[model samples]
Target chain A: MATYTRKNAWNQNGTFSNSDLLWYAKGVRAMQARALNDQASWWFFAAIHNEYLSGQTTFPGWAYISAPPAVPTSPLPSQSIRDKFWNQCQHQSWYFEPWHRGYLIAIEAQIRAIVIGLGGPNDWSLPYWNYFGPGNQYKIPPAFTQLTLPDGSPNPLFVKARYGPRNNGDIYIPLPPVSQDCQRNTIYTGSNAVTPNPGYGGPSTGFSNAGSVSGNLENNPHNMVHTYIGGSITSTDYGLMSDPGTAALDPIFYLHHCNIDRMWASWNAAGNANPTSTNWLKGPAATGGRKFVMPMPSSRAGWVYTPNDMKSLSQLNYVYDNLSTGITKQLVGSLAQRLTKLGVNLIQTQPQPDENMDMGGNSEMVGANEGALTLKNSGARTAVRFQKEAWAKVPKSLMNASVTKVPDHVYLQLENVKGKMDSNVLAVSVNHKLAGHVSLFGLRKASSNDGHHGGAGLTFILDITNLVDELHLNNALDADSLDVTISPDNDIPNDEEITVGRVSLHRQPQS
Target chain B: MTAAERSRRSVSLLIFVLSATCWGLLLVKPAAVKHCFVTGGELSRTSLEILLLTNPISPMLAGWGLMVLAMMLPKLIIPIQYTCERSFKNRRFRAASLFVLGYMGVWMVVGALMIGGILGLTLFMPGSYTPAIVVGIIAAIWQFSPVKQQCLNRGHNHKALAAFGRAADYDSVLFGFEHAVWCVGSNWVLMLFPVLLPGGNNFVMLAVTLLMLSEHMEAPRTPRWRINLSSKLIRILFAQTSIRLARS
Candidate 1:
């Protein structure tokens, strides 16, 4: 008996019908009615997000797993169990996709069981809110915004703490342009924790326990959505969705994550690879070899899963309604062209000798060693202008090639960053036009006491190829020298020292 | 052996000889000095006065220099090796020597300052354990500070050394100086503990050396409430042990 659950788009009118919404509301109501301490209760599910297990246990139904006697002396019997199982959300790592997939499955199973108990449909699957979907669908689903269901019962899905426009009125908050661009990232993974490869997933982080830098997908859209929803439009008060501890309490969080998970599926379908590293697949667990363990209802004996188990939806006995076929082909096809264009640009940029040059004549040799610049005490906006000689030395053939033919993907590489962790995002631009930005969300410098530099401060690579073309800098008529400006998204203190030991330009080869 | 291997062996040998010489001096030092260090015994007023009058610069510097060689040289092995690997094969010795000179120069200045401070304090404030005890407690507290961690982190930071010529020489010396500054910043308080103590006990010096090395070996600890608690507990335990020893 394959448990095939249909996950429809939240805002898809015909796909997620009125009856399905009613059943979901009823299931949520039933789950909420259960004692907070019960494993089946809504509170028990949310407690998993509140990492401080000992503190959360005060809200009934939250029980700790008893430690086996074989285990060494328990520090504080209760704390030991909480430490072992609680606080296990994998963020800022490659395992972000697979781990969350398993988590969603576990949560959905509990919801389905409740739905069935309430005399709802047997196949009551979770509805995904595809915020990145085609027009009008980006808005918050009406079912979630309504205070009451069709029967005049209080809607369990309604969360008052959400962003103003979505909660107060019908105005849907449009996704920021930064988030829209993240969807165009063709790469699935990066080499290290901070390689800024514009990958859908993050670099290889062992066990997904701790990471200094976040993957492009995790940093943008995923993180941005949380902050935007949680942050007030008028004031600085962060809503429940703002912090990871309280983010899950908002009903919309599940739907948002489901969409993200769907993106991963779509990314894979469009021809991208999940990390095959042993560290990622089994995870870097010392004792159990390599397995990701999640605490669930005792009867189910908790879900101990691996990345291998999450590769396909069939293994989990469920599939997204639009994951395989729909808009993915178009999205993937366009993305492939962009990636190919980048590859062509790399080839075009390579310095080649001119055929007109005399073979026997002494010609000035262009020095390969373009001098490196170190920027210290960089503020909110720091600009570096390339020396005229440096730009002049570039071979005429490399500069004369039509920018359209090349499919440009130029990158500004900021290497060996050392400083106190500043939360401000650095948005890179060429001349004055917008290029791309790197968020310093998780990559804060560890306080001196911890001695952890989070792998020696992250190396950010911001793609500025499009900016060059848009500014007409590739043309001979335009300025020969390039001006790269690093502008922080927020006002950063002028005194804060952010030492970029080396700054260089790189052309990423198309895979 | 290959030139590189031979150079590495020579560096190791130099460190070993210096350390052994320091240990030999400690073992064979005058009983008066030994008594002052081990038992926390104070010098008689007449002996102190005579010591202040006599030129003690040569002996004091030699002793301090040897102590630094024995205690700190082992810790420099990694940095020295890193420099050697980056340097041209033939110039490895020269690079290593210049690095050592730069590093030791910082310590020599610190050593001279300590001698001057100690001599002045002894001359003015005769027979006072108040300053020593206060300095010890402060040093202990400073161990867990963020500044200390920053210094340790800075000490761990190493840039790629240049392969040859003036660039190589400059990089080697600069790296040594940078490393020395951070190392001293991180460990100065701990180093000051034995110096400030009533007597220059070899045991106390060895204990401080071990503590410094242990902290260096451990991963940089972020300042967390739990870590602070544990550090406090360790301090309490150490105090308890000291009391027990005094009673015995």
Candidate 2:
């Protein structure tokens, strides 16, 4: 009943509205303000949604809203220089830039329509919880949502996406495992006979090595939208008596998808601006985004989605309508808080929880490295012996891998190497491509030469995000996360095989 | 009358009035629609407004979009009172054209008011939905008002008009407003809900869609239902208004 009336109503310029619109209006603004804190992230989200919107209205997929990502083989740029790489990376060029652009613009329009349909913008700014950091680390303004729950309520989910009040109180709702039937829908199709990229990309022979990828997924030479993070929407409500995808049952999917679509669009926009640098397209999509199955020759030894394939945005019938800068803030604000927690703290100044950096800045749980980590003996000043074990927290850090987001993949680099030639600098790595599984995904290839004296200073890059991403559905997971192994060749003065001296993470500024 | 016939006439009149309004307003005077959308102003007589007047479809589509007013106008204004008044005179023949044109003109002008009102809402109101929806719903139900009935009916069959076109003018006026009222009653809720979609997902699009189709499906054959449905809507709207008023 709190709607405006003839005599006392408000216009955009005036303070009009029945009381509820004021509150409702506030929620919308808050959503926007929260997003604006980081415009780049939201732009990427918008691109993904836009691509889906466009494709959904056009080609229309069954069950899922978009058709799988397309993989084109005929367009290959063949050359003698490409032959150096292995065969598994044949069809890996689809998940690049301008393609992501189409998706970004389309979804922007969808959310805008929702905004206009609501009422319009009430002025608001994205707010960063002091719980994360004070400054640039958590400043994206536009990704905020209508305040879902009151602040300070303890979120009880495992692998916690929640951020605020020092982490204990806020966590995500523990997710149920994918139902037996749901897994059936994710049937993968990969090929072994055809080597994907003969020479252009990375190792084609060992793609599925040691649980690297879903064999069929990596082998599938198509499906671009599947990602390092999440899966694509498949069919819906199979239990319905009569199919109603056309009937528009559960229309709420559109709005939820608007968020998903927005994420993809934002990613696409970023991809457009920063196309992979060297050997970018020369390699296959590290993740099985564009194709159903990727060629994982290395992982054939243990576990891997050898032929990993992903879906394409064009297959989606819908696209995002490009929106004004003012509109994307709600989306940004929502994501910023989550990123603050998962991403490592990178503020260079005072290394503690400050308003300007991530919340965990100063905790002993996290350590810093000037570059190559330095190790000193417990009692000795000359730092002659490297310890068997060293550790620090790294929620934010560059994931090193032939392919990133391989769940729990951890790669250690030796920064601030201050020691004698024979003094050892040890590098360690852990790769857990799937959860609850052993570190079969972990690979340890030393830097070949550890120190100048060649006493054995090893440098290894590990990627285990895939394990984290998949197993994360289980509540038991925590910072107790590990797999990472040290090289057998490296000589740590002590009995422990691997020692991590320092850890650091990186993040962008909040413009 | 058959509901189908009424629907057909209703649709034709809606299209006719809309097309006529577009053709007429653009040819005669149409500064309202052009500048209204971009600058979000309709009544302003600025150079931007003048530019709009010169642009054809700018005002044409704008004018057409609002002729929804004319659909409900005929049912409320030209019907019961005006044409009956015209039927009694011998000069009713000449008066039919004048009256129909006048009646059509009145709705067209009203359309402009709405087009202008929408412009005003976007420009002046900024981001308020309550006012826009309230206005749309009110404009929708107001067609049933006795006063609106009198103005539309009387203007169509003034003493001079009544003296000119006898029975035909009587039918024309009666037929005219019936056209207008039906449209306003049917489209009001659907259009109004979009204004709410942004604020809350709870508005329930499916329920609202059904209500609108039900109203549109039975305009003449089930005048009772239309009246019943409209009365309920009118009451609900004002009931909402009163509560809001109390809160404010």
Candidate 3:
């Protein structure tokens, strides 16, 4: 077997009309023509990730103006197939990285097989949309923007419903899709049962379709790209990528996930480690005695996978063309220089993957708002009053080196954030400075209340550790309350209100 | 210890003390608080009506309240811990106290109604093991019912409460009350079955409490009629034990 290399789509053949993209389009169209029940069909492959309401002409949270295509009907696939394979995307869990990696490989194999039968090259690999790369990469590739290909055939890559920032047919992400923000995280897993904010990869969960407390990587870039390309905050007609149920249907969804997969590889190359815990390594079975299985192209038995099986890219027989980008190299280089200055040899003092990576520790809730806040499209501010007793025990400076040997990390959480739309990117600021943006990706599924989170809705925890330290330096931390303003990135109508159940503050004093 | 950890320990301790006390009370006075509506404790319609009219409600309620505290409080540690941790440190005790009050208040009202219903059943229908058997069947049916699962799933939801002032107190009470309603919806039939039993009420209570705790530990799944033994915790323990044995 030949090792497949996934290259950046922007740099492929130095143009958009590369052989890889062309063959991918052809393969997708061919697959789309097959029956929905066929495992190798485009719809089946997408449904394996997630599926929309079976017979509903109108989807949830969608207005009458945006009627979805007729949902495919078929004689029921085997109960075993449905249970083992369909709708098994692992979101908001530690398995988010590994589950998707296996999923991509399975689908990639199917696509590659079809492409080969179509007389395409043998070495064809899935190209990723690295919007984080240099140049005008922020825009949708010109291939997806055009209504027709060079031969005047309808472009399978082009999706007309994509209502980007302008709410027009333009399907481009105005903001940077992903950031190095996720790379800073060291812990691979955290449990939502203990704390509101879990880990970098996600909280440990059992057979979660959409669990609570999404991992850091899954939250940003992954979600941000999905929501940004699918629709704007104000658009009523959201594209397929906007909703998780319909996200996998879009041709671009695979490319977006490919980039997310590449991010995991890059994070590893930077010396960050995955969890070695048996609970994580064993997949859902270790937690709930359930296995993570997907339908194989050739067999009815399907393929069973565990996080342990996915730890090695080389073992998987595929690798990204470039794992360590310039940005990653720069961050890793700076850290190396810092270690050298501290009289520690970088190579000799290399930390284990799990070392000092446990961010999901016991955090004390020091403050919270009195009630839920209805976020406005313009902006809304709320005050989180500090618990005077707990606040008294807090160090003068949050930065450990400045005040105490053990640094206390502070976090601001938006608990039970319920909204009907996925495009409501709330830019959260503390004391009039940008702290972080809360991406409403997968909001429709997550906020269903009937879903994994129950009626608690969605909770977002932002590590405002450095921001708090800056406040302390400016003597602003002495205040009885901290001002939190949540402003939407796009202008939304007054009717569509995003209700944040409560805005609370937590402090984790390192033990 | 952190306030949240302390609160959790405190709640666990409270459940322990309450359970011990209930068990002690049961051992000392097994016949002290018999539900006369039980299978063999039959009475005529006039006698039952007279007993209902003349009997002091306070003592009977006090007994039921004790039973509720012991059997139900174990399931509440998670909610109480969250309530305490979410509250301001100075107001933690007050918040948790109000939450208990709100929680117990709902159970007391529901318990009174249940007692009245059992008395009514004794008056109208001939009291036998049949009524107990029927209620048990209903409870079992409810255990697999979608509506009950929905209630159980909703029971896992913990609302974000206000940290200070009257609003905080109100929110704490509301949160507790909401949780108790769902708790009652899911398990009231099961609780009623033990009460209506001819005998072995204490033993049944213990069994039902354990069952409730096991189910509560499970993550919310799609509400359906399928069997949900909620052996997630048991699976975890089993996994841990096997791993340890292997390592050893």
Candidate 4:
């Protein structure tokens, strides 16, 4: 059978066409109508989430269920199914990408089977939101936002528990765009499970949970999207999407995860290699090594899977409709190689001279700002503004050279960060205008011995190359400075001090 | 060995020798104190007066200092090595010494305050277990408090050191003092547990030292209301043992 293709929700123009939307709504309604005990029912799909939240069980009966079993006497018992499922979901591990890939495939198969039974297209596949793609399509799809279908039946895709802005009739908040640069991280994994890597996946960790650190992609687009969609009104309560335990309950969860899985597939196609270590491919399940076991009620048995089994989308009978990950891979590879060489030379030959100025002189407490650069803080914003003079110390010639270089990425480095990880998503604005933001979801506090910790704190590097041009600061001849403002999406407690030891601007060389 | 490596070895040797001597003295000391006035212990007015009138560096104070050296100095290896690495080649020993001095200075002040507080308590009140029980409960409560976690987190913060001269000297000492204050804030209650325990058990002191060391080794955890004391401690112990075995 030909592999199914998962298309972007905004495959046509900038939004889901009326027909695609209709089919999706109908499929969801059909799945919801099935008996709660039915493996293909919406409730059955949701139970997988509940199992994960409850954590691993120790009961003998639950721990030893057979895999890919024959038809069950009753839809696998919701409460009684012994160790049948939810044993694996990779969080802060090298195998995060593959585990989630297998997970998405399992759900898609069940959903597709139901859709076909309801007379939908035989080759139907899950649709991705593609929130990082261009234009207003990043906003919640109209189909999901609508209270009822065109024929006036209640839309199953509409979830009431979503962020208020998303659920409230007309007023909608567009999903924030994640940096493409983060997706370009070349390393597959780091030295240890807890150390942060440039890879698309996180550091090594135990089953269904994150280690001390989170991967860049998982941290930003993956986590930030959840918080943004979940909303941030009450400081005490994280929105449904924000917390992993309840994230899947939201209808948008599957679609969002589908997009992440697609990105992983793209990352692989670009030229990076999945870990081939025995520990990664088939390590012991008890120690959170290799081998992911997920329960499949539709099949009436559990399935024990490995990264090797899920490495190829074709093996799972699926492909993305419009992915050009190869092109991105090549571009990023060349740029990264050039930067690595340049970095070595810079470190060896040139040490920055002391400017005799106190580095801490520029420190300021976060405050609300208005005017052309409107700093909105409705229980969801925390911002700090850096004056233009902060950049005066840098040589004008060097600054110009950094921007003119095509592939060279400029970054605002936040060093020695000390604050609660639960604070609002961090956004960077150039000269009062919004540039881009990074999600704090899954960020680990730097341990004392971590090389990156440097006794100060963890360092966060945000790419601001595109922001410079977008703000029309690219062509100024004289020493041009920017009022770079760093802000969070939610209010931090006044008593809690979130200090950035240093904020310096630097550029990475490109090929 | 390279000059840098040799310097590192010499510094480590010096630290190890000094620490071993203190620990040796501590291990050989009598388990029970006859004349010594234990902090928060049942006390008599005459014993309190004797403690107050004696020299600050009396045999009791010496024992306390030795205990601090043995239990706490092991935890300072990473920071000490870090300071040594950042100092000038000729002055590495000097920087390390100053850093140790600053760290010990903070602990000494804490020791003085503790002694003074005990003297005051003994002088004002009759011998009773009320203060000890209250302190024990407070220590248990603090184990699960957000303030304790914050102090522990702050203790892990490492700042960059200057490479040479007076600047390096000043920064090294300052960093040590800062780290010592946070460490004490994080672990003072645990340290006081044995002191307040009736008849001061040496095993409890040893257990508390192990706990302090293990907690410092792990990363900061999110503050939660639940305190699974035994399970967490067991996990840390197992992890430490496994690490040692792997290294061996």
Candidate 5:
């Protein structure tokens, strides 16, 4: 098989054209016309990612399959395919990157076949929406926004329900929320053991849907994109892009995920390693075991895969057109601007170690709030009292930047965040300095602890080393308690809908 | 500490007290504790009046409820912690109390039915371990079954609770009941096995309790026929030991 290069959707390097998107739109339209029960239908492929509310008769703005035929539904998919492949999207797990890679390949193969049938080029690959690319790329591609094709036919890529931030059917994704800070993470896998480490991908687990905590990459740009493009948090019916179950139903979702896959490739190119563990390579196993399975577009059995099978894009017969324009470049530029505003001497300062280090050792919970705080439309605040005894347990050089190369990292953890809906993004700050934003994009699924992380709910650990450094510089580090504020970026009608079980702080010393 | 933390601590204390008291009673008065174990042979052999005079319903129910509090309350920390955390700080205790009441209420009803079933089985086949062994085998088979795994998976489910008034109370109780329903569905056979044994004493109960706790700790997987011996407790213990050793 010949390798194909997946280019940027916005025609960043001027290599891509309108015809690529036109052919993609045509393929999508052809797939949409198939029966809901058909294995190769657009609904079938989307359902494979997730179909949370499958029993519901209506899906608001989009077509829904109320009751997909039972196993042995279609001969093409077969009973085995229906049993294992549907609703198998790996979210909140280490397998997330690999699982989605296989999903995109399977869907792309189906679409490519359909495109070929419609007399399109054989080498056509899925174009990625690189919102972090260059000038004016943050906005939704014009092709997706267009109501009709050049031939004056209805555009399959265009959906009328997109209720992005403006709530005016425009998707202008803000650059700040979708930071590529995840590229700085050195470790491939993180542990939620006694000492929690937020890995670049996610924590190690055996087949997780909503694991304890999201890997830094999944938490940010990936989730941020999902929320903003979906709609405003306050909207009655957020678009198909809001929730994972309906996200793939939207045409832009594939391109969004294609860019996310490119991030993984870019991360690897920077010399970061993927996990070499047997558990990760072989997939989650116990008695019956679990494997990544997807229905092939042709007359063949379902394609069974492991993380090992998806470890290489070259092996999969595809490569990204460009890997140089990942989020790290934007992050560095933004950091320099922030530091300049703070009057830091850029020439004299030494290059600091990666702040987002996944230190695997004994991390202590140094402070916590007295009770859970229900985040509101206006905002919520709490005082996390530092345990006096905990300070003595760690190295005295904790958060002391001048004395150590690998100083202890102070992390703010929002534990067990439960919510009824998605598309809410909360700006979290420590002592009034903006630390990070918690994107509750898949709050519903992540909160449903039934099948995943044992009701741990969604835990977010934001690195606040720099914030702590500032606090130390001002002699504010010795205070008995730190004021933590959670303010929603968008208005949330129901205060009862979202609640953080606890606001705690931990200090992880470098190993 | 936070109200949620306080609530969890209190729950731990309650479990410890209940377990200690029950275990002490079992040690001091094994015969009296054994009387609480309902059996068909005694009911068929003795008159109703004699049975009432010897084995009273009040003590039996009390012993059974005490047993449940000791053996099962530990398994409910997640939902109880969640209930407390979700409620107003002042109402945390009330919310958790309601949840415990609702959980124990379901287990009480199920315990009565299980007692009745044990009586029937013992009546049909008296003075033999055959029935007990058969029930044990059935429980073992059910452990590997897909339906049982499905029930275990459902047991981890929790939902957003209302923060105020009767809605909060109702939601807490409803969550408790739902959790109990799934819990009983997954462990009914394992629970039934101990009751069927001739000397179904506290020792057997303790062993079964450990098994159930271990099973609950395992992450949910695809529902299929498979043996699940993954002990998260053991893993935690090992990890903690390593961390401590490395630190020292």
Candidate 6:
């Protein structure tokens, strides 16, 4: 998913966007429906899986082989068995929704490949799990119980297999198969539903990884919440994430990231798009770092995510399509032309148009004011500094007061930069969400191993005590928060050079 | 041949001649060049002239273009020589890996010394002398040491040279890996320069590169040295492994 708000951040929904996340969720859900509608689809496949594990099947040529050529319908369910299955499922929380959404996508893709054979509309497309990549910390959920169906009854294995030897060892508990069929009309405990993590996206949304957050929930972006809860997991294996020990192995890891991507998408939408508004996320910090900040994929302090060799979503061979779509309405009007005509001698005269037709730079934020823009430093980032050739306004008194409780502290309305210009600095203030936070990124000259001085310097991160201390908030300040735009330091070159960079808030206070 | 005679002749005849020949080809006379100022510090002509005079070898640092040294010299020449004696010398694990051991032993001491020199230069130097003089002294002094011989990959002082006129694949690989380790160790001093600077721009890159270069040393050695070989090369080809594992 793209950035949720104008600011590059995870949505409160805790989502990430990728074609895989969408396609996989849809695929998995579709597969689930396929499996449940005709139990033969899933159960038959599950049987083959069981046999393969138990050394029974000599040549299990296919994932499934439905008996009675015609798909079975109105299947008879054993009362006791169905009741037990329903009973077990009734207890589960829906927090697994977006999470399972990814696995189902992958599983569906796999099934499509196996049954339909690797191409066409049913072509298999799986999540690109960072199996051997960096930032590998996957925790397997306890939901996937490895149980065998003995004469159609769920039988328990590994009774003493690892029973008392590890983790208080209670041999066997009644194993319940992972099912999504009984969920209709089921009031899900929104608390645990795998929705967008508040840390990443806004409320009531699933794990979106919008890169912003508004709705408050525990590990809303459930996948990353694993890292938040469990210490960490390495890239273990694929399609085998199980137990807390083997989560990284699960093929679902990529899907989890995809959902997190979605949460981020939602967050992009959640941000206050108004050019003069402020969404109080948190205020300045008390040294160390920002009161709050999100972990960036490739940041120096947190897991920094940069555009990889094939990092752009466009480059990915796989693309995810959403089961649902958000409204992307386009405006049809000529307001600017009308405004020009309305200045009929009654208003002030407009300035002569500049010669350059391409006034916009690629890096410019789209909103009237940059909405919750997220800037980060990687590789031992310690501080953030900002400097510029122009004057930057401070936050209003009310907004400043809001910072007292850390309602919001983000930069806004940054001047666009283009080409390789000389040291044009922007203001910088490190948000305290991690260590080595930057308070300012003084002006910098970008040169390719030679003299090609350019705009905006990015200084090494250091402690962010000063910016937080000089708290400037702008509530009622409208969409464009005034205090956030780094004021150009007039004392220095004072010639078009500006620098702006800030460290994310220091690790969200342990919680 | 007497060891001293063989070593000296090898150094003078092969290494020196080859080195001079290679260096001779790369010498480019500096002409009109772009002047870049660091920190808006006035770059005076006097400063440039003085710096040029002092830093004679600095020009060769980048445009040295002697990449063949990294390959042909270290990789090919040593393999042909080390092979002849590997079998008899190995006579099967009787002696604990002389080539890799000796090569690595020299590598460690040299690496440490180089590292120490770098630390001293960066931490201790008062910036009293010109870079040319400093580098010249460094280059001159290095010429006499075992480190220079190994790093340059010349066969002089190469103990197994006569014995293994055409060494096997195993000996070559061991020597090659050892050479890689030493190469890293040898460059430690020079690599440290970029990292120690206190700024963010290019200085940070230099620091990171230094870190990566340093970490890269951890490869091809240590626990990897602990791998066991199959039956065939145990006694013959050397650290051919299983023998090392058995000893361990």
DockQ of each: 0.08, 0.00, 0.37, 0.08, 0.13, 0.01
Question: Native-vs-model 3 lDDT?
Answer: 0.71
lDDT (tens digit, per residue) of candidate 3 on A131-243: 77778777776777666667788777776567775567676665543465676555566422112246668765532222456788888877777877877534455667877
The whole-model lDDT of each prediction reads 0.54, 0.26, 0.71, 0.54, 0.69, 0.25
Per-model TM-score, in order, reads 0.57, 0.18, 0.85, 0.55, 0.73, 0.25
> For candidate 4, lDDT tens digit of each residue in B1-248?
11223444565677778777776776677543122235342345556446565523465556666777877876786677656544434565787788888888898788767655655655654355665678779888988786777676666666645433466678778988988898899788777666554455467777887778656654443334435242334553454465457659
Best by DockQ: 3
| Winning candidate number (lDDT) | 3
Candidate 3: clashing pairs of residues: none
Model 1: per-residue Cα lDDT at residue A497: 52
A190 in model 2: Cα distance from truth in Å? 79
Q: DockQ score of candidate 2?
A: 0.00
Q: Which whole-number lDDT from 0 to 100 does residue B225 have in model 5? A: 79
Ranking by DockQ: 3, 5, 4, 1, 6, 2
Q: Per-residue alpha-carbon lDDT of model 1 for A1-511, expressed as tens digits?
A: 4565556555446122556666666766776676544555555555555422333242111232121101111122243344344445666567778888887877777877777877877887877776666667667678877777777878887765555323333425445533644444445563211123535677555211123446777877676566545433222222445555455666677777887887777767666566665445655342122246555544434678877788766566877778742332333234233434334333445443321111111111111112233333254333433334433433232344432222223456555455443334466666677666554433333322233442345455565545543444445314534566665444334444555544454333221
> Candidate 2 docking category?
incorrect
* Index of the highest-TM-score prediction: 3
Retained true contacts (fraction), each candidate: 0.11, 0.00, 0.46, 0.06, 0.13, 0.00
**Across residues B1-248, which tens digit of lDDT does each residue of candidate 6 receive?**
11212333343356436544543443323432111101111223334344434333333232222322311232222322323212232321222234434444444454444433433443333232333245535534543344533333222112111112233334444554555454543343343332233223134333333333222211111111111211221222232243346557
- TM-score for the B chain of model 3: 0.85
Indicate the TM-score of model 4. 0.55
The better candidate by DockQ, 1 or 2, is 1
Candidate 4 chain A: worst-modelled 10 consecutive residues by lDDT: A356-365
Off by over 4 Å in 1: A11-78, A151-153, A164-186, A191-198, A206-211, A233-236, A286-291, A298-301, A324-381, A387-409, A413-429, A437-461, A469-473, A476-511, B1-248
List, residue by residue over B1-248, the lDDT tens digit for candidate 1: 11223445676677768777767776687432221221123433445556554526666676677777777886686568656644444566798888888888888788788777766656555556766787778876777677777676666555545443586688788888877888889777677667666655577778776666545544344332222212322343454465457659
